[model samples]
Target: MTARPVIALDAMGGDSGPAAVIAGAELARERYPKLLFRFYGDETAIRAELARAPRVGAEAVVVHTATQVLGTDKPSQVIRRGRGTSMGLAIEAVKAGEAQALVSAGNTGALMSMAYLALRTMEGINRPALAALLPTLKNDSVVLDLGANVECDAENLIQFAVMGAAFARVVLGVERPRVALLNIGEEELKGTEELKEAAMLLRAVDLPMRFEGFVEGDKIGQGNVDVIVTDGFSGNIALKTAEGTGKLVTGLLAEAFKTSWLTRLGYLLSRGALRALRAHLDPNAHNGAVLLGLNGIVVKSHGGASVRGIANAIGVAHDLVVADVARKISDDLANFHAHRPAAVDLTSAK
Candidate 1:
């Protein structure tokens, strides 16, 4: 039997509080039976939720925290005074090897800050990038620098491609995943110097992934590429736009179906397909966003995530731990550095 993976949870992180965190753990327990948890938060609240989820309680150990990181708190504040907070304690568990991974539904900035400071970056990684699976027409695509470093340069984007490809290989189970840099146009001369430089270096490097040059924003959902790399500014905007579009399309569909008897009948006929679509677009299915390039595995769950969403986040952490994604990333980065042409300068011009 495979060894159980222990995960640390920031029980006081999300908007729904400890109850949702525990409930989500219970749900994850059902999916991954060989999972263990270390919950960090208010003992009383955690115990209360655990009582309602005895199965999860059976596999959980709660560590009480006197304070918790607030959504409004800045990243710097959390880094300086957050050691005692629930989020801080949870990350500490991972850093200390008490847990293989950490799953937090707290402030993104705070999570990133603490994880970065505690775990630090990997040997070849300049900065950690936020990566997540985006639903697409063909299959899920991994997009990185979602909001981690807003002003990344060519070297950063190149590193993101390497990291993102490794993530795709592990999570998506793709061999030689198709990688591309997000650009304004597919043409080589269309994007900024950073993108052009990144693309040039990526093509020169003999990496594990298949570099597919550049792709436009419209091609993201088309799923022609397995990994999309960009600076955090553009990547974050693309992510938000995709999310908003999914919501808008779903909302419009609901309103359209309720317009008349004819539409209602049409909806009834296509109910199954509609449900599938809804499931495909559900943020809960893609709840976890990983802070890649960190020394330890850290997954960020949406603040407003439901129990199911939180469970998915935990599942993502479990997958990363079991697959040893960090090791794969390190190996790939080492290969890239070894094979990179001497003429290519990886320094950031910004």
Candidate 2:
């Protein structure tokens, strides 16, 4: 653990191109002085941005030239013949043991495809899920399958629960994290057949988490639960809804503050609190979306994330790598299989 972590960067993938990636790496170095980086993209452009930050120039950053992948490229196409692209080479660095993790602010589907194809899934994972840390009333909670697999059966849902619980344990440091399935109502009779079946499966297994039956949509941000599990179709919708609502509330507050001189004075009086609120609701603060269940760590940042946002994404990758999340997931799955009731068939109901 004493050795510095090396992060591979896909410098040419995002909306802002290599400039934002380089700037973000510079900012990350300030926080992690010993952190190393491998910049995969056009060397000339990477160097140009590197020159802009003197402090970063002094750090250990190796430039690796790569053919850029366009946003218009499809996942299927990328998986077949995009190995030489910046995103592809970044993932290759992790697979080749050259870097601890890979971070990209690029096309979500393409990143997932490349990561899966390159690093492959962990032992027990059928498919990797997209997980995001959502801000809640009490604290942030982990939500999975943000947009990875649209359709999931009972077995897939159960796997997501285990993965999500491990994520909360590592990232949130909850000893016995509370895991819940997202449903229409809290009652056992509610939800589709898949939800009910998944619930039955979780209850039968002696997993490390506390499986709290079912949680409704409104409770997602309450922080009463540490992890929320759902299909990608539902999880993705909920994520976008929450993000949109946050932006709407922020805009309303800003407009309200500018309404009158008295309101403006009130805003001035509450400047400190407002600053705290801004920081709390900042999308950039939670820019990293982790691709779970993969053998190697892959973090996807928003395509339009700012410099600080990109730095935050890097921090997510760094934390997951340090926590050895993949190994923990493997261990947990091993326990699940060993402790599961003999009559219970995990392959059933799917």
Q: Give the top-scoring candidate (TM-score).
A: 1
The lDDT per prediction is 0.92, 0.88
* Candidate 1 all-Cα RMSD: 2.6
Off by over 4 Å in 1: 345-350
lDDT of 1 at 160: 93
RMSD of each: 2.6, 2.7
- TM-score for all models, in order of appearance: 0.95, 0.93
lDDT of 1 by residue, 1-350 (tens): 22989999999998998999999999999999999999999999999999999778976899998899999999988888999999999999988989989999999999998899999998889999999999999999999989989898888998899899989998899999999999889977688888888887889878889999999999999999999999888899999999999999999999999999999999999999999999999999999999999888999999999999999999999988888888888898888888777775534322
> Which residue pairs show backbone clashes in model 1?
none
Q: Which ten residues in a row have the lowest lDDT in candidate 2?
A: 341-350
Off by over 4 Å in 2: 54-63, 344-350
| Local lDDT at 108 for model 1 | 94
So what's the TM-score on candidate 2? 0.93
